[model samples]
Target: MKRRTFLGSVAAAGVGAAVAPGLLAPAVAQAATYKKRVTGADLDTNSRWQVAGTDLGIPYVLENGSIGYLFGDTFNSPWPEQQNNDWRSPVMLRSAVHPGEAGGIVFDSAAKVAGNGRAPEIMHNGHNGIGIDNLWEVTVIPNDGISFPETGRQLVSYMSIEHWNPGPRYSLWKSRYAGLAYTDNGNDFVRTNLKWFNDADNADPFQMWTMQRDGDWVYVFSVRSGRQDGPMMLRRVPWEQLFDPAAYQGWGWNGSNWGWGRPCSPILNGRFGEPSVRRLGDGTWVMAYLNCATGNIVTRRANTPDSAWNNEKIQVTFAQEPSLYGGFIHPWSGAGANELHLMVSKWTHGPAGNSTAYHVSQYVGSV
Candidate 1:
């Protein structure tokens, strides 16, 4: 994902980069207010997704049934003729269990790239080969099966530009907020954004997790910002306090932030992203996420979501080919039985592009 390539395409297309309008319009804003309480029980895995227009990629499910996803679409918007190289990234949505119920907000990237260039651009721009588009947010209401509302309302939208030879080249663009939703809109929802690390010469992909370990409180686990040193940057925020505007900043832990106790192996050293956290019936929290290019799914456990985590282990390895990108884990019930399941996307070549699928594996007890 070179910065020059991304910005060059944007400039070449001559599309004006404009800031997003304020919140929802009056009519839609009024509609946005809901008296009905949307609960976790309203979300289900058995529900299917209808093809909401495949502009670039396929959509997959996030932990449990709270989120759905699509990625890698390559067509330019506002005008279909100007096609950039097919360098699409991940897109996700909030979903409901019942057929025609309303879910939460959706988030996605708006960038593309092709061919090789300079290592400088790649390092400086943080995976320069990939370009992100202005992030968009959508509200979903199921229509029978997988069919959803075709149009999505805009939340925070912005594009990234790469500093270049002439001036700042619009290399990478991003929306202010990634599409994430919470029920109360109080402390349950947290606001965060991506920032480029010029000193590290790479972009860190941040992952967010919300888990309930003991009582009713939810714990927020953020992978903070990642460098080459591995996914050691870990932070915990009380769920009830995260939504405060000022509390959202500086959540990363300070210190070594790596190592394993006697019972656990040394934590892998590298960047990590796409984290999924779930609580087992016995009251243990299990966290799983990808470690950089290795594409290995690693797990860690903690008695309380905010307590120090331990027992880091590799759950699955995709050494042969890295088909599993941006994955999530959840418990699924079917035919009177329930088991742990993983949903991942298979990157396709040629015209088909990409599609997501689910893999079911029994929960053999968490460490």
Candidate 2:
């Protein structure tokens, strides 16, 4: 079937609703929820160790003999707690060479503030006072590279939504904003200046994924927000034009559409976030993300990154715990074989508490 027609049929049937070529509509909309939950019950939960203490935001990079993760320690407490714990404002980067192995580079700053108090400059705000977190990098094999600076560079501004409480008169509005930047040292590494990818007013910037189709040029995918629906909006932008002021002027294609009834309609009422995309063997793109409402990890596939994606959403991991974050796929992990791995952090009772312990799972068969 043509891609567009397939998508139209899928949307008409409702998310996860099965369809027949010409069957009668059901008396009610199929339950827009998953029936099962996946959690860490039988696995060796104690095997995974903490990469850093006191920091929440985490992004990883895996390559031959090495795995790197970057995170920051700045805590954005809501109005009440903000009065006390104001000292937790340092950012850091760390890595491990082997899969379960551990070791890494740490970068910290002498300054501390709610927003980092730095000027907003650079791609997402590279030079701005915003704390640096949510890191991702592309690697060139044969020779691995990793380094850290005594004084880390400021990348973006972020606010934590987990810190707020809502009242009848005052609504809860919490979010994180990032400015992107990269640099080339006339040698191996090139750093691009940060650009404003988000504003401090709305939702927080959760995680970002990037893919390079041809060469030199790159495209970025981010999990932003739609406040009312509460689902993360998946957005994409070209690397070359990312830093331009006008780049944010018009909406560029990022696979899904904004409102209801479109091919790119928000799934599971918008609570999805932490998205990671991988090109399948057939050249189709598959995305795995957190289904917040059901607290399960689910998978969705698309013929292309732009439009006409499959409406049949599949639940991959059935974690019973509060599984809200961490979804990733490592394409180069096995020899000539693609492997899918997913992680879910355990639920926390409060902002200062640790994330639920994480659980990782591999795909059952080849894609």
Candidate 3:
């Protein structure tokens, strides 16, 4: 899990980072043209998901056919004061709502929180000196989670942040490391030993990731810790070797050819934040993210996950909607069709007193 260890694994896999790229060209191409639209209003509000205000509404299919979402920095009450009452990060919510009825997604939800009706902070935030290493963690932000049909279990990736600096360097959230946590009951989770450390630069590529399982392998598309800028990279591990960091392989250009098992390389380049990728029911792969360059939620499609990612991007939001990030693909939206439904978040920060627009909206997009 350490950087050297990961590099060693890459070397042990028979691919060196110093290898020349003369065999093939990179997998980037001109963007394809696509379009989108807002299908409904915000999908989550203060009254729903025990989440008065939260972000990162990434959802994945559960074994029981329900949808499970991972939310970040939550405030269950009013703003400012909302931080005082039952605020927790990385909360999980379960919903039985069908993808077709995503506009009403909040109606069929319940958090892990019991009688209090608040969603439980499924992972430790390291506030009480209790974390994977017993150190007080600055924060815990959920990246993305996936449920494996082979094991009927789920694995979630998260960042154990160190601190967040104020403006001028707003986006640099110094992360302790990025680790994996697994759950069997969907409610309780246990952290695994697997982690990718953030060294001097605090820029680890696996910090933010979205995963999808195809055949025996789970493809991981990732970026660095800071959301401002970084190229998205790709890696894969056998479903059975999910926890074995050494078993993972990267897809990259060997200079003359685009192939698998090369040193990890960029498939898509941009000022990307949290991203979501999933294969549509029609067999197309779609990647959605907050484009910091344009300040909009955009998406791109490809025939295969490893194909040249240069497809026309579809803008998923409008100019009127600002201060928005997070474009999580709705699991049920691709069940039997390519109807794209996304869970988008909006958060505008100012001086402490203003009412910040912090909630998740459901949007419908197309290729």
Candidate 4:
């Protein structure tokens, strides 16, 4: 496929812009609409989004005129005490977002049992007890289909079983399972015991990311983020049986037909960051994630949901930040031929000279 440089950065050596069907038309139109690259300004420059040392921001719009973001490794206190203490807590930040507001988010609740198992949270190792063995990261979405119960809350699903105790660094040790949860007022999210997905080993531990619901199925876009931060894995279950493990099936993309398979095959290539995916008005799927190699936000597009994706463009790079990690697309609303909104974050420990901190910041761009 023929291609040209996007501005000056996205060349063939960088982004893989294809000239296939449904790919070239968008590029020519985008060049005419946007200046060079699609970049968004910070919503508020006065104050950054404050929370415990956290990342993997999953943002969604609520029914009560507010925005909610579910995050992972979200601490209750400061560093060392943050991830080392209650490292597996999944927390939320809710706010009435405005353009020029100083501070962000109105209410930030304490960490609760967002993704713990049915058993007691305290795990007795014969002598001492531990409770940080449940969910560490999550991806929540609203039930957009008809005939669904109006819980005044959005339907939530998350990944867990991150064993952090009796270990060296407390890295996310093997994802356990994915389950369901829900909340309305933005805080007080309740997780259910029904685990709908899991893998026996770390070969392909699915880290649940962005979710989309069509007619009767809820399509989940996840990554094998543990053993190998590989391509995006797709899974779907009937809308009525989202919490039932037996109701789900990992899509087997075998070049020809997409069928059921365990430990779902990778759809894209290269070790990746935690990703967020959504369908555009033109039936193309757009996925945005932090490219670990470039320390920049990268994206890819696919003609079909379970097919080979093309045109991986490096969207934006945070040059001043350290540990500039992955990006998660704001799942509710943020996309166009020449513009999109995203929540990207970088990690921070203690001090910095003159750089961004450990807060999830928003960016809008035309990628």
Predicted candidate 3: what Cα RMSD to the true structure? 7.9
Q: Give the per-residue lDDT of model 2 (tens digit) for 246-266.
A: 443222324533332222222
Model 2 lDDT at residue 347: 30
lDDT of 4 by residue, 186-263 (tens): 445556666545555444545545676556777777764342334556788887786577877887656565576554
Candidate 4 CA-lDDT value: 0.46
lDDT (CA) per prediction: 0.29, 0.31, 0.65, 0.46
- Return the TM-score for candidate 1, rounded to 2 decimals: 0.42
- lDDT per residue as tens, model 3, 185-290: 7677788777788766655677788998888889999987666445678999998998988898998887787788889877765556688998767777878876
What TM-score goes with each of the models?
Answer: 0.42, 0.47, 0.81, 0.63
Higher-ranked by TM-score: 1 or 3: 3
Could you arrange the candidates by TM-score from highest to lowest? 3, 4, 2, 1
Off by over 4 Å in 4: 1-53, 63-66, 75-88, 96-153, 161-173, 184-186, 196-201, 227-231, 259-263, 280-284, 318-320, 332-334, 349-356
Per-residue lDDT tens digits for candidate 1, residues 118-192, read 101110111243333332221111000011121121111112223322222221222222223331221121113
Lowest summed lDDT across 10 adjacent residues in model 3 is found at 1-10
Is 1 or 2 the stronger prediction by lDDT?
A: 2
How many clashing residue pairs are found in candidate 1? Answer: 25
Q: Is candidate 2 or candidate 4 better by lDDT?
A: 4
The ten-residue window of minimal lDDT in model 2 covers 1-10
Using lDDT as the measure, the top candidate is: 3
